[model samples]
Target chain A: MDFQLTDEQRALQETARKYAREVIRPKAAYYDETAQFPLDLIEKGFELGLLNLAVPAEYGGLGLSHLDGVIATEELAWGCAGVATSMIANDLALLPILIGGTDEQKRRFVTPFTKELKFASFGLTEPGAGSDVAGMSTTLRREGDHYVLNGQKQFITNGEHASQYTVFATTDRSKRHKGITCVVIEGRPKGMTVGKHENKMGQRASNTVTLTFEDVRVPVENRIGEEGEGFRIAMETLDNSRPLTAIVATGIARAAMEHAIDYAKQRQQFGRPIAEFQGIQFMLADMGMQIQAARLLTYQSAWMLDQGQKNTLVSSYAKSFAADMAMKVTTDAVQVFGGYGYMKEYPVEKLMRDAKLIQIYEGTSQVQRIVIARELLR
Target chain B: MKILVTAKRVEDPESKIKVKPDGTGIVQEGLKYKINPFDEIAVEEGLRLVAKHGGEVVVVSIGGKEVHEQLRHALAMGAHKAVWVNHTGPLDQMGVAGLLQKVVEKEKPDLVILGKQSIDDDQNQVGQYLAEWLGWGQATFASKAESFDSENEKNKVPALVVGADNKTVRVVREVDGGLATVECQLPAVVTTDLRLNQPRYASLPGIMKAKSKPIEELIPAGLGVDVTPKLTVTKMSAPPARKAGIKVPDVATLVEKLKTEAKVI
Candidate 1:
């Protein structure tokens, strides 16, 4: 029932907050403008132990708890959601291996990332299948000691730059979800090609592209689990990851609220500050309340996951609520600034743009609703 | 070169501070706290010194339990250990210096570094008082070659350089319109100025490592130091609010007001 963060968690939060304020926030607008992958900032974050947070201590990683990871994520997102997204994509990429990989597999694949500043992308979504997991057309075929992968994964974050990929494909498409399998592919093979970066609507600092694997030979040793297990593996990874996503949204909402509060108190109209008006005050109050509620839900879901509890329902609740709340709060922040908030010169409009993908990615708000309802019925 | 550095928990300058209704102190309700900025620099200097000279840095703070936050911050910045002087209630500059002297007598570090002034009170007296009371050589307002570039600060080249003999330290002090250099014998005290070094943010691993670092607690009474405030405040008050300025219609009116109404001319 206690709500206080442990002293170590508080120290970790402070460190992340300081790093975000001093390093990431200053360069956010620049990266967003050029849409360049912030390699330097990412390296700095890696050096600071801000990346690869969930990797086990045995592998030279921080081995931080889910609660600790979310606390750091929120502060980093408060600095810049786009940069934060790029940072956390590594954890998303590693979750599959962590959940299903053997000790040998973890040592071979995950340990290398801890020693260097390299990226590994989560390969799931395809051009044909966004929300429908079973609709993916990526196919895997066995060949003696290896598997041949043929697929096109679209909207793959860190795809162009990753040295490794944890990809999901089906051995038998007719069997749908039950037939899906996951494998780890190291580096680009002869038949594989990385597509040009996508000009995304928001979180543009994060590199997103298409990956085409044509007869890509992956070693059998790299397979995460038994055949027909990837659908659950991917779902579990999401369950473990959704709380982090929800906290990122909370961070964005918190950032937007702070900007709006500062602007409201200073913006003058009708011979006084706009903050003096009831309309603006009410908007701020609602924003503040919703941010707190979303944060509480997010922490609870993350805490439950850390405690080895089934959090499918609560994770969805947190993800959907926080994502929707971020979208609303950032938009309201823009509205609070009136015409000025729409301009590129101001920061709020960028936050408003950056918050859109949260509601749509990971699990869309609609998808989250479906999960919540199904869990309740079950 | 075993070094002792001070970390004083102070009100974050970013937090909006209000004097209490009774004028006893600031309103504590929504206030945030952080290690004093100058003290953070002093800790950084101690770390840099130990890194090159092959020794350890021990950070110490005097306050109630909450001061552990600042002590932990210093530890996370790479201090080897901490000594928390457990006490509460008000303490003036003399009281702080007396307590630190006792801790110094016990720890017996070869060197001590402190912030030139706490941001809250700007007393700027603790280092000097401790040095005088201890009968040790003192160097104050330590600075370095004037540069704010990140490159210069990346390696954290210390301003307080230890001599080749290992018994004396050279300090660059910021003085009026120029920098002065002085050499002090071992077991001396140094206070840090702003340009000593840019403090580093604690890395995640450093924060985790700090959790296991030991913090030994000692009460003022246990140290046989009397922490009675010799300097007492009669009252506290905020500065008067600024009045709005009237706009003059023209240069002639402005000149007339300056000459007559304001009577400055």
Candidate 2:
């Protein structure tokens, strides 16, 4: 029932806050402008232990609580959503192995993550299938002690540089969801190719591309859990990952609200500070209210995950509410900035752009609503 | 070389401090405590010395049990051990310095470092008093510090390398209008300025390890030092509000205002 963070959690939060203020917040626009991956910043984050949030202690990870991880993500996201996305993408790739992989598989794939600032990806979502996990056509055929994978994954985050991937492929398409299996693979093997890199509207610092695995031979031991369980694994991974994304969403909303608040107080019009006008004051108030609400939902969901509770419904609620609120708040922030918010020189517009992705990734807003509805009906 | 450093817990520099309604103390409802910035510099300097020379850094703090947070922070910054002396403060500069001198006698470290001043009290006298009590050469307000031939046995501090050639540490301090460089032999005291080094962030691994590192707690009474306070605070108050700026049309008016209204001619 206590809402207070432990001293360690506070320390971790303070570290991320200082880092965001010193490193990420100032460089966000430049990284966005140049549309370059922040490799050095990523290294700095690893050094600060901001990365590897999900790894186990035996693997040299902090083994941070879900709420602690969320607190960190929120601070880092406040600095720059694009930069936060790039960092969290690594954890997104690691969660699957943690959830379903064998100890050997974890030791083999997950442990090395702490050793360096390397990227890994959760390989899901094909060109033809985004929300429909069963609609994937990637296939895996059994070979001697290996599974030969043949398929393509579109909008794969960190595709170009990820050293390993927890991939999804079907052993039998006719079995639908049951046909799916989780396979962990590594490197640019002979038959694997990294396809086109995407140029996106926001979160441009986060890399995304299409990866094609043609006759890529992965060892059988790399398979996570039993056969016919990939669908459940992916859903649970989303359940865990959605809250992290929700925290980032709430961060974007808070960042936008803060900028708007600053603007309202400083930007003079009609011979007075705009904040003096109820019209602008009310907007700022509403933005603050939404940011607070989103933060509560996001933090509650993260705490639930930490408590080992079933969180599909709440996770969806958090992701959708936070994303929608961020979009609204950031747009209102632009309004507070008047014409300047529309320009690249101002930070609110970039914040607005970054806010758009939260509703899109982890699950689109529409998909989240449907999941929430089904959970309610059940 | 074995180095000892002092860490002090103070209110975060950015936090607002206001007098209590009673005027006897500060408002404590929302104050965040952090290691004094200058102490962080002292810890960083000791850590750097240990990194270059084979040695251990021990951090000591004087306060209530809560001061362990600052001590753990020093350990997380890579100090090898910590000692906590449990005591509440009303101790003036001399009493606190006497306590530290007792610790130095027990630890017998080759080098002792302290922040030149604490942000909370701004009392810049503890290190000076400690050096006087110990009869050791003291270098205060050091902005930069380096050890010579640290890797070679010939220049190793006698504490760790007895019978070796004399080892020394060179330090530059900010003196009135300029910087002063001084070199001290082994078993000396050094006080750090803000420019000594930028303290590193405690990595997550470091934080976890610090949780397990031991802190040996002691009581001031057991040490048998007179820790009675010599000063009492009768009141606390916030700084005065800033006066709003005024513009004059010409230099004549500006000069007249400076000479008359402002009384600053």
Candidate 3:
């Protein structure tokens, strides 16, 4: 089978690579250190048509294929995982609109955000819900033409800065998964409060904050799907997003591997380059192999998405494999650094920290395993 | 009033180019090509002028087969139509200028826009040659553009006034020291610089619509233009790589090194 990227795909990849090298790479460390959002870079991303890749042509989006999105995401992550995370969070927030929102909703909410480079957040995880999305306790009760929302969401990327949110809440408490419903909440609506930012170990450039909904009112038209379809919507959104997370992981791992390889050649030990050592060479080889494998799996899952195939199994496989590989590769990169790896002066430590989150967010490695098992068992 | 913008496909601005071993030209294999950066500004300026004035914008390019990408890019930037004059191999500045003259004669547009120079050659001669061929007013290295009334044509009135009263274009050009602004009447050739308006990224719909925009092709012979190179390259070679210098502990040491070791300061 031909493995080379098509001309269009290669062009997108080259564009992303140029952006990563010129813009994102320069600001990554500063944003991580200060926990400041890279708003300027986000604007640049919008200018380059990197932000809303999957939104259709009719809505003024690039309508890039899923594989194209994955390729772009990987390159961005290679520059700065945190910045990449913050930028791609819009994809997650816009998924519900792409999947189920009405034309009016799409025009009002989705189009503005994508067209104007407005940041967005997805609110599914809560104070009580982490991996268990069904355990979310947020509620939306219908009252006349509006729905009153209650409860809080935590650890939301771009939560503090997003102009809009796609929030999941319970419409019927009696039924577990069937009770969940999705709503599009405006960021500055009455009774909505953005809590203090979460100080994380890495990916700090990405703003993770808690969102409190104390009787926040949303229009009934803002409901994404049927009353009990929140669970399905959330799952389908994850099905699209898991590959994205994998792409991010692949990016981080690729960066780490590239840094390690470069270091091995330049770093001298025992009057010779460390790359000459079998141990270091072996580490580099394994890192390269894992990154390539992870990239292939991630692209395959994205290709499956573009082809309209059932990607539940492939996405789970990619997410788990790439996330776990990123963690391993970054850790190995640190090992290659020896004493320098432990200090914040070196970037591998930061990479290690950034790689950790990929395994935790979207769907945890455990959750990915469960999905894979379910698919294989069937 | 119709405006024609000339475009050239060059190596992608972001790509690093290497010269061929034969010392004649740049190595073309595996290199990415894109709409010339300066030409993009020219296209954007043309579109903006057309948008402000009630007129049509058309893009014209003379190159090999790969030049169609640049034509499509102009179309995506809101140009109404495009024309491509295909040449099999590389064309020098004179050949390109001759072909462009043919296109200008065929289109008979009121205004012609082009980049000050293509990035690959950096000759900065095509616009002047085209202006000479067309016997039109010429403005080079424009940073900003405005339409105003021509002082000489104050007493004359056209049948239709689409934009300003006299159809005069005010242009800002970068000179040796700073910027100079000049006004020229219609039927002029204006070359663009980077300070011109930033070209808009083609939206998905615009790109799709550009596929259907009419693109007419013409050969040099068909256009009655002699396409022959007026200049020959003597040699080509890569610039030497900058050497990495030793790092000092602080600025004081660096200053000391610069003063003592380098001896230039």
Candidate 4:
């Protein structure tokens, strides 16, 4: 079992880590405070070819391996999960098009993304359908050459910023999941109105808002896969994207753990460094253990998918394990920091807040467990 | 006009170095290497000049086979081609200047651009020595990016090629007190400073294409120069630790201590 990263992968990792230190990490706090999207950094990511690394070369992307994307994402997330989330969410939107879109459709939808740092949302979840995809209330009605889209999507990331959206809507609610269709909305279709921006506890650098679509006209050609195929497309896209969430969780875990350890080494209590205490040491040890396991699981899932192996089970494991691990590790990190960690002045609190969302988004830890259990039953 | 830029791969500036137990040298077990920052600027400057004056940019490096990676990086930064001069042991500034002098003779580029100094060895001597060996005028420690007329030879001068290709260029260099601007004829060496220009990241497609670019490796022994070290480091050690300070009880006591004990008023 050769586990060593290839030289090219190592180069990708180094480049990203360097960028994280030099660019992202320094501005992380500022962006988080102002809740401003880092457009320049996003442009820089495009220049560095960090955006759309997995998309094919013909479509103006690097055609990099899935492992390379995971490595890059982890390094960036190490800097700041909010900025990293905003960055990776761009790739999240592209995965569906790359997976299920026809060549002509890819040319129409994904090619423009390669040239710029424009964002796109993965629009499966609505106000009513977070975990239950079949329960999504958004509807699409056929009108000759176009489908009229109407829906209310809540907690949608990059709602006001994305030039396009990979939105899912049911053609027939009676048919449930079988009636779902995935459609690409280009440049914010005329009838779509972006609603109020939501102020979240963490990952604030990302723009999260409500999207209101009123009879938005989308051409039939923009549909990804056949009608009723949206459910599978969404599932497969999540399967491809779940590892990214795990990588982000691992990043938050590592970042918080690192700050806690550094603080511990220097912070003195009772005439000795807090790190000298076995209790603090044990917390650090557990933090380290959790991060390593999450990272390993995340890497294994990404690698399996890259090798064209089935990854539903491992992907769920990574997402579930990493989400829970990040929460525990970050909370412990705050514990290691004492009262200072509870304050906003310290970074551990922010990490703790960010770690909570990982357990809730993409797929919750419970949802992931359900998938894992299904695999076991199968 | 043909522009020649020198590329040097140095240990990553961020990595910490520790003297060996025997006090010989720092551990090189897992050192990360990258194109020195100044050299990256030089390569970028060379690319910019070539872009403005329609010429081929050739990047050259004197190192072992491993330096090919850096050379490819230079090519990826948009250099037209690259040359690798192989050497095994450490060489003094003069030795490196002499080897580069051989490259100058063969390539005979209209202009030679190099970093003011390598970060690994902060000796700012190669650019001067190289120009002297080639009997060409040089401008060292060039001022930051600014565009001024060549007529103001005492102020900031941008390294801009005027009429004939990259033949006649102007540069303003950092001087003892202020700045000195120089307008040198063709075949002159210009050592770039930190502020010349920010180096562009090598694009993915460019890097992929850089792999196929020709890199002609030459043996330094055939150049007929002694590539021997003329300097020695008797020992190596880190800087001394900084001492802690104590707080004074009052301003009068602090003043008294500063005047009598610390000897500063």
Candidate 5:
């Protein structure tokens, strides 16, 4: 099989990489330190069409392929995973509507985002449920021409900033996954409260908070699908998103490895560059090898989705491998820098911090392992 | 005004360059290529001119198939179309000017903008040569009225003021010490300096749109231009590495060394 990206794909990658280097990398540390949402860069990203890659062309969005999305995401992540997460969160938010909403719903909900710079968040995780989707305590009740939504979605990305939210809540908790319903809530309703931004360990540039929706009214027209279909919709969205997550991890790993290489070549020990030592070289080699493998796997999974192939198993493989790889690579990159890596003065420490979340979010490494084993057994 | 802009593929200035062991040329392997930075400025100027005045910016590049990358890059940055002069051999500035003269005869653009010099060669002759060859008025080293205001530069506000008559344009030229303003008539050639404008990045949508834009290919033979080089480099070599400097104990000693050993005084 040929590995060459199409000319258009190459162009996409180049554009994203250039934007990442020129606009995002310089401010990454500042955002990380202050834990501020990068609104200015997000506006620039909107102008550059980096924010909404997967939305359809009919709705005034790029309608880029899954492969194109991941390709661009990798470069954006290389700049800073936190800022990249903030940018890609829009894709995550809109995927549910794209996958399950009607054409009319897409026209009403997705088209406005294309015309201006705006934020939207995917609301799935709750205070009670992290990996267990079916066990979430968020509730949705049928009302006259509207659904009453009451939920506390914690660790929600773009929670405080988003003007729109695609939230998942159950209509009947006893029915487990079958009871879930997906609804699009635009703007804050009467009783909804956005909590303070979480002081996260990594990826702090992405705004994460607890969303408390008390009797938030969602229009009936905003319901994504049948009551029982939210589980399937969320799963499909994650399947589409997992490859992108994997590539983001790959980007972080790549950046860390680059920093390690540059540091190793210049750093001296025993009157010679540390790079001359086999210990450092092998670490670098391992980092390089794993990064390449992760990148290839990520590309393959994303390509499969674009080709309309079922890629759940492969997505899990890529996500788990790339996440674990990033955590290890960034940690080793810190080791390469010795004591300098531990300080805020150096970049590797931030990268090491950033790599930790990739292993834990979008289904933790353990959850991904479970999926892989389940898929294999099936 | 219809504008013709040149985009020359050159080694990226940031790439670590090494002269080949044979001393014939640089090591091409693993070297990154980009559109000449000055040429990129020229393209930006053309686009800005067209943006306000309402016309097309046609970008042209001369090289082998690889130069298509440069052409596409210009297109991605919002050039209307491209003309590729497909030839893969040595050509001096004279040959390049001669070839462009042929393309100019065909396209008949009102203005032709080029980089003052390609970074790789620094042979700032092609624009002047083409202007003389075409018997057109020329403006070289085009800059802004003052030190660039970053906001205006980022917004790509045109530095060159086109006369209300539409047949003349006023340009700020960067002379040896200061700026000189000149007004040239229509069908003129202008070369861009660094301060002309800050070139815009090719947005993702622009890149995708560029993929569908047409690129017409021509050859030197097809244009009836003989590309025999009048200027040839006999050999290539890297500059000598800079030596470490010795710190003097006192200002008097530093002054003495500057006057005698360093020979600055």
Candidate 6:
């Protein structure tokens, strides 16, 4: 298969990169320092059709190829991972509709946001469950034509500002993983409460807040799929989202490399630019090499998705490898910076901090390894 | 009615271009190319016209094989079809305009739209030349276009073109001082500026569909026109770099420097 991006994919990548460098980068530090959401950046991404890259064209969204989505994600993450996480979460929220929603559901829930700049959140991880989908305790009980959901979801990206959410809750507690079901919850619905924003160490520009559902009533038609299919739906969602995460990791790594390369050329040590030193040169080479490999894997996984191939294994591989590579590359980038890397004044420190979350969330590094191992064993 | 929209692939509008070591053009290595900013507006206007007036919007371009990429982009932006006239060597404004005129004669589109000027050259001369060759109405620097039934003929719908007004097409041109609304007739060419519609992103399905849409290539002979350069570039050079200026301690010192040293204030 050809690895070259189609013209549209290339254009989307360029647009995203332009937005990242010109708009997002300038405001990143301020958002990080103040722990505030980058609303302007988010709006700009919406305007550029970067916010909801997955919502179908039928729903008024740009409906980019999975590969295009990954490219855009990488570019946005390059600018600011926190902001990227917050913005890209809209895709995660809309994945259920893309995968299983009826035509009416897509129009009502997905189309409105595409007409404007709106944020969405995916509610899967509860206070007690991070990587354990079967362990979720939220419940959606049917009552008449509606379902009343009572649960608490934590660590939700864009939780505070999202207009809608894709919330998963157990419909039948006896069936474990099979008992879970997904539903759409309006942000301002009755009995829905948004908690205080979490003060994250990195990606501070993204708001991670806890959402409390107290008898939150949602239309029964809002169930994403048939009963007992929540686990499968969730896995499928990750199958699409994992590549996006890998893209974000790739962006972080690229940003680190760029910053390190520029720093090496400008910052002088011992009567010469540090970039002239073989030690630093090797480090830069290694970073570039790993970043390239990660990008290829990430794009390949996205391409597989576009081709309608089963990409669970490949996506897991990309997510695990790219996230780990990002962490290492950013850390090494800090090393390239030496003392300056430790200071916030330099951008590498921020890149280092931002790179950490890619390995933690969207199926932690350990979880990704588990998936890869399971697939390989199979 | 059939319409033709011309677009160019240039350095991304947001990017700051640096002149190449060879003085002929800007450095393109590692730079991203996009539909020329003004051309995007023109494409959007074409699509809007088609959507409202009910017609097909075809995009035409004259460049290297890479022009197909921009053609596909226009198609994904909702153009009905694409025609790319491939040129191996660079063409001056007059030569490119000649090629476009040939395509216009072949397609016989009711209207032609293009960017007021390409970002790279900024010559702003191709549309005028093509309009003159076609002997059709020309409207330059159009920000909007609307079609309504002419008051004189209640039964006939007249396209309310907005930008430049000439012998035929009435356009509302943005002058150095203010805006001037002028009327023009059909079979006209309209060039766009920045204030036109914000072009929509090509949706994934649109991109996929564009791959299937026919993009016919016409060589100079295929269009029954001889392709020859009308203008030659003997030499090219880079603009001189800005000289370093002294930095002041604060706003007051900068004001003093501007007033006394530079003598501008």
Q: List ranges where model 1 is wrong by over 4 Å.
A: B150-158, B252-265
Stronger candidate by TM-score (4 vs 6): 4
- Best-to-worst DockQ order: 1, 5, 2, 4, 6, 3
lDDT, model 4, position A168: 90
Question: A1-378, model 3: which lDDT tens digit per residue?
Answer: 558786456556756887888789988989999998899988888877788777876676777789878988998999999999998999899988888888888888788865577888999998888888888889989999999999999999998888899999998777878999988987689899999889999898999999999989999988998898989988988889888899899999888888888788889999999999999989989999999999899888989988898799999999999999999999999999889888888889999999999999998999999999998998
By the lDDT metric, which is better: model 2 or model 5?
5
Name the better of 3 and 5 by DockQ: 5
Each prediction's Cα lDDT score?
0.93, 0.87, 0.85, 0.86, 0.93, 0.84
Span of ten consecutive residues with least summed lDDT in model 3 chain A: A6-15
What is the docking quality class of candidate 4? acceptable
Looking at candidate 3, what is the lDDT of residue B59?
A: 92
Please give the DockQ score of every candidate, comma-separated. 0.81, 0.61, 0.14, 0.39, 0.77, 0.16
For model 2 the TM-score comes to 0.93
lDDT of 5 by residue, B86-199 (tens): 999899999999999999999999999999999998989999999999999999999874446567555654558788778998898989988888889989999999988789
Q: Candidate 4's residue-wise lDDT over B104-151, tens digit each?
A: 899989889999999987898999999998999887876654433244
* lDDT of candidate 2 over A283-361, digit per residue (tens): 9999989888888898899899889999999999999999999999999999999999999999999989999998899
Give the RMSD in angstroms, all C-alphas superposed, for model 6: 7.0
Residue pairs of candidate 1 with colliding backbone atoms: none
The DockQ assigned to candidate 4 is 0.39
lDDT of 2: 0.87
* Residue pairs in clash, model 5: none
Q: Each candidate's TM vs. the true structure?
A: 0.97, 0.93, 0.80, 0.91, 0.97, 0.77
Best first by TM-score, ranked: 1, 5, 2, 4, 3, 6
Tens-digit lDDT track of model 3 for B245-265: 888999999899999999878
Give the lowest summed-lDDT range of ten residues in model 3 chain B.
Answer: B154-163
